[model samples]
Target: MRQIDPAFTGQPTNSKAHKAVDPAPTRWQYRMERLWLTPMFRAMIRTGIPSFGFVFLFTWYINDPVRIAAMIDWYEGAVSAVQDRPEFMVSLLRIEGASEDLQDDIQEALPIDLPLSQFRLDMGELRSLLVDLDPVLDAEVRVKSGGVLLLRVTERTPAVAWSYDDGIEILDATGQRVATLSDIESAGGLPLIAGEGAEKNVPEALTLIAAASPINDRLIGLARIGNRRWDVVLTGDQRIALPEDAPAAALDRALAMNAAKDVLARDVRVVDLRLPGRPILRLSQPARAELKRLQDLERLSLVNTEGTQ
Candidate 1:
């Protein structure tokens, strides 16, 4: 038999014996390696990395207000640049249903510079400004194709001329002030109203004037008596006192009587129709003198006839 070496016999040899192989891994290390190879572990790793990255990014974003504001400004600027393009610009304004002077006033009141983008104009604010004008009763604004802004306006119509302490003012049917006039003559053919609270009853006064159409040309103006009733002033300084309850009806009756009896044509200072059933006439100085003279002549003639009998 051949002699066996000690190394082969499980004894250490002088030459570096084959290094003892590392012992099998520890239990914890073995378990870790096994767990790392599992599908669940891989999934957890994938999900946790993204979650951690998100947390860090979110925290950084919340801590910086200046950065957020800068981002917002950048977004607004980008959007504005897109909207302010030449195709979206409003270059001309077209106004309709306004007089020449009113058109000039509207142009002066507009808050926009020419050639501005529609996106920069606030339609609501522009509408409010237009409606605030004294002459503008109603208004409409629209953006048309071809970069034109269309403004349609409805102006107030003067229904009556009011005489105030300052001057004469033209009023619409609703008692709204339309414009100031130099005098009553400047009001054209509109009826005149005077005294406080007369403007509030313009519609009623106009109705009464309409009822007195037969004598309207001779009717001068209407005065609000004690702010309750109306006194219809006619030419030659004649006044017709009207009842407060139904002045229009009273005026119509007086006009009808005048048409039949020529009462208004007579030399009367005042025709008082204030009482319900009683009508009083205040004659002018010449009319009163002529009546007294006729009465004396009749009495003298009657005495002479009695003496002859």
Candidate 2:
């Protein structure tokens, strides 16, 4: 029952004499490997084609001239809607330069409540009016989303009050006319300046007066002379005639005399401290009488002492 190769048994047989069988072809199996990789490469192309197609379609739709025209129409409608609102009109009473109430006048003309975004700000009439009223308006107006106009303002500070060309006016410290005023009492601590160029020299007078205040509280007012000379006035209607050349020295001497001899408190009419070496004293009648009484007392004491000797 066992079949054995005759070559191994060393027996010659026809079946045992056949050639060796060949190995199966591996090339056919290699061709099947391409199927696995082909699908992945093809799927990449399919995904990119649809993505690109959607991008081109949407871009064309949005940027088309028709869409741009529609946007313009919408903007015009929005502007017309709010252009007639009441808030855009500015109001002024007795305010100068504007022919009409800024608020009321503008409203009457424009009659629009259009939001700022829809309107052109560079219109010639608007810009001219804004510049013309810049000094008074101080506030810039802007229309908002709810058809409400917003105003922001800043005003300048006036410095002084003055009387010029027979008309009284309030001026800033720099001498610019601010407003017309009634009288000097309401003008506050500004010096009563008169004569030529008083406004120009206010700063100098203010400086000197401020310096003298700490030393003398009786200094109530000042009078300037000939644009160069100055005179100081005190309480009780007493006037101190300062020197034309050295006013500061005159004031210093007067203050010194007041501290040493209570010159200001004396019943004197005026103390002419202009001459430092020899001051001219103008005495009231009562002050003269008091001086005589003091002299008599001194003489009587001397006479009594000599008698005792």
Candidate 3:
């Protein structure tokens, strides 16, 4: 500042008084300090730079067709190396609690080949497929050590032989069909039942057969009449017509009568138990003829004796 004596100048010089120096920081410096204080900005400055550089270099390197193909091949090769391990492969299927025939069926029905990766086998789908078989009640599938796939199952047992017109099918205790039979003798000792809807009412048929156990040797089979009633068929072409309700009781009554009066042993074609109290006996053709002849002979003897008197 150039100062002049007050005496030289009359009152004040034409010099602008210097404004009080401003104490605040410059605009650019303040903005830079504010940005540095922000946590996100600091983090971006520290980590984002290296991340962006590495990503850029990697993308540029893999942009070529050859390099891209090679990278994909390396990934696939690594995955194959892990998946092809012996522990991850299934070489043989071990079936437990299944018959030889059923095992054969499973082996033939499986959609996958052996030596496949265990990861490729859907356990839920495999179990469902096994349970869908007629004989399989339930099945459990699992992967075991030594590259084996184990299947445990429960098989249904044959309870009765259902004889339809076309063929016979063996059924379980719940009337579920198990398998078709080649012949009736193949049913072992299972009782045979046949009629319009006998297969549907197998439980009732079984009950009736059980009630007729006394005459099992003479029993041929049970015939479902009108899909509602049962007719106990026996040898000699005889039948016991049973009522719809209380059929077992009706059968018991017939058995009791036969035991006492030998009704079943006689030439009776049918014992009609449909009516509650009185049972009508329909005689065979030969028995009816002999009965009519005997009645005529008695009438003629009475007439001859009266004329002589």
Candidate 4:
């Protein structure tokens, strides 16, 4: 008996060409396949204890002393290249100091034949300092044989400094402490501010004075008082007391008073504007004679007016 053709019987025949065409993966499936194929993950072993052991042994043997030394040397050379960059020099004017110390420290920390793994840049602390000095730093760290570590860096330039109990700490505009001043000599002519909260308040005072410009130009130094108020020392050795609260207004009032009274010429030692109602003044001893002379002139004028009437 002849077999019936299924196609003719209204039952479709199954053919290789007619099967669901799944030629290539969907975009999602392709991404999923690639995700597990990452170099780190792909290198991991899925099966066999011996295979894993063999891989571990091979890597351990290959990373032995001589190869590690070579890697360390290569990294050291890279570090030298980084340090030699002109931008690095500009960013870190004190690079010579930090690098000089770092060189001695690194040599002591690692031996010549030591691997990169033995060396460390102390980067967590050092990196932020460098970055704060210059934000453009592109430092990278690597370790080699016997623990030899290397640092490749780009550094930054320092602007302002903060005076803390620990010492004067250099900082940029962002207030990140960069480096500590060594002694009075190393600190040079940079503005010196003292007191517990001087670092925080001094900057704000400077900013406010800067905003006031030529009016506040006579200000020579600022002192933080009672950890709450600010007192200004003018160039003429005159002291101006500012209230803890209304410093700006007090400063403006001082400027206006200076213009009107010429109090500095009158030999006033202290101008206390801390109280708004009454301005307190301390007259210098030398001005006592002048004060008496002015009073005598006023009394003579009053007598002459009464005599004429």
Candidate 5:
């Protein structure tokens, strides 16, 4: 046998004589320490865990279509509840610059019912409907404070009453139609115009009527002759032919002659002013005979005077 060392001998060793031995780390703990030192592992712990949790929640939420639809419905209902409050509701419609009839028509054309929320009303569509009326020139729609739907309109004004084969049409100053009437007599004091394209020449016709104001009350109507000239008709079915050019001047001249010579009051059927230089008069049968008789008497008086000399 080999010689036994004193440390291996089964004798009491001094407490401070042996060196202290350190405990070795286990395999799993050593591996965990190494992983914590890596940059990729540290980055995954910092960012990857939160990302995975968010993705899991998102997938769970999207998997149920009915729940998503119910959430949307709840959101819409909340919005609608806020919008349908009494403060935002339109209970009355206030119309300015419109007649009673036009107001009725506007009410008829409205797309929404009264006592409804203003949030549901489309102002552009409302304005378009109001503008479609013949008399409405322009329309403006707005919501005012105190829950009022304000509609301000500009209406066409009737300037003349036109009479054609169909009926009477009321026209504005711009020759635009305002309304239609069954007869010219029902159009109040507005001057009557007849024949095609007469409404377009209303300004000239009005000028002519103004020029002949002295006999205006006795005037019956004005006619557009072949769409070129005007014929001023009097109460007794007498017609004054007007020249296409300088008609207002010719009318003034004719009225001046009538004031001095009583030309119009005489038994004349037609006063022909188509010729600028010469004015011709067509007399009734009785007036023609009387004129012939007067001429014969003047000639007889001249012959008797010559014979006596």
Candidate 6:
């Protein structure tokens, strides 16, 4: 038996009939197929989508204020737990090279409480605070291994006592102000300097004081004159005014004169050493009047002798 042609039915067959076309995909389907073939789209599917989903869920979890507060509290609690460990605690403070009075000042100045965490201490700031004190020349601060806060301080040594119009202040060798004293005698045998700008010329004053050692028993102090020169004030109001340049040499010269002639013991008010070659002795009021009276008597005698001759 012959097979029947499905295209040609038992009815009329028209030669002019068009062939049936194969079905095409929809626009959305075609676009989806094209997108699937792209490498960027595949990468987005592999990584971007999962990352976005994770971030969205995370954001939702943390969006609540209560959850944020809980997270912050948990972080702070963890930090506090680490900081409060026994091994990291500073329970003792040891001060070295500081005097008893300085220790008291340091203790009063420190803004920390004992038995604190080492992590909470600011070493640099503490050292700066210690050095800021007038008596403290230098300082070191460190935390030892066995929970000790160690402080090493170097105190300024008082070299001279500066007495100005206001008050007296103790100065170190470098002329740094150390402390205030009630009086010049409280400086404890340190050389005394007086008047304005005396503190700045401490070295010069000390030199003069050294040079005047021979007459130290009669020396009172060195006074700064016009912030340029010094006047060595001795007992009985005798002043030896020294020049600005090589004042130590001029002081030495005056000291030599006093030693040789016993000039300072006389009725002298000032020994002017401003000129290196020439020394002027300014006598007291009584000595000046007496000298004037003797000069008048000598002149009267000379006049009377000339008239008689």
Best by TM-score: 6
Where in model 3 is the C-alpha error above 4 Å? Answer: 1-78
* lDDT of candidate 5 over 18-40, digit per residue (tens): 76576988899999999999999
Q: What's every prediction's RMSD, in angstroms?
A: 7.1, 14.4, 5.7, 16.5, 8.8, 4.9
- What lDDT tens digits, residue by residue, belong to model 3 across residues 10-69? 876445653346789899999999999999999989999889999999999988999999
Order candidates by TM-score, high to low.
Answer: 6, 3, 1, 5, 4, 2
Could you tell me how far off, in angstroms, the CA of residue 24 lies in candidate 2 after the best superposition?
Answer: 83
**Global local distance difference test of model 1:** 0.89
Candidate number achieving the greatest lDDT relative to the actual structure: 6
Residue 21 in candidate 1 has what lDDT? 69
Candidate 4 segments exceeding 4 Å error = 1-186, 200-202, 215-218, 259-266, 293-309
Candidate 6, overall lDDT? 0.91
Clashing pairs in 5: none
lDDT of 4 by residue, 63-130 (tens): 88998888899999998777655433321112232355444543344323322122233446554443
Model 2 Cα lDDT, one tens digit per residue, 1-309: 989877799886685568767676477666756653687756766776777788899788769889978888999887766864455432321223333435454444443344443344434544345434422334355544444444433333444455455765555555555445677777676544454565676655565566566445677655665766666667776766666666777777777777798877877677776566777778877879898999999999999999999
Return whichever of 1 and 4 wins on TM-score: 1
Q: For each candidate, give its TM-score against the true structure.
A: 0.75, 0.41, 0.77, 0.46, 0.70, 0.80
Q: Write the per-residue lDDT of candidate 1 for residues 105-178, one digit (tens) a residue.
A: 99999988979889888888888998998888999998899999999999999888999789999999888888
Better of 3 and 5 by lDDT: 3
RMSD of 6: 4.9
Question: What shift in Å separates residue 304 of candidate 1 from its native position after superposition?
Answer: 10
lDDT scores of the candidates, listed in order: 0.89, 0.60, 0.90, 0.61, 0.89, 0.91
Write the residue-wise lDDT of candidate 6 on 130-218 in tens digits: 99999999999999999999999999999888988789899987899899888766788777888888899888888888889999898
Better of 5 and 6 by TM-score: 6
What root-mean-square deviation over C-alphas does model 4 reach? 16.5
Residue 20 CA displacement from its true place in model 1, Å = 25
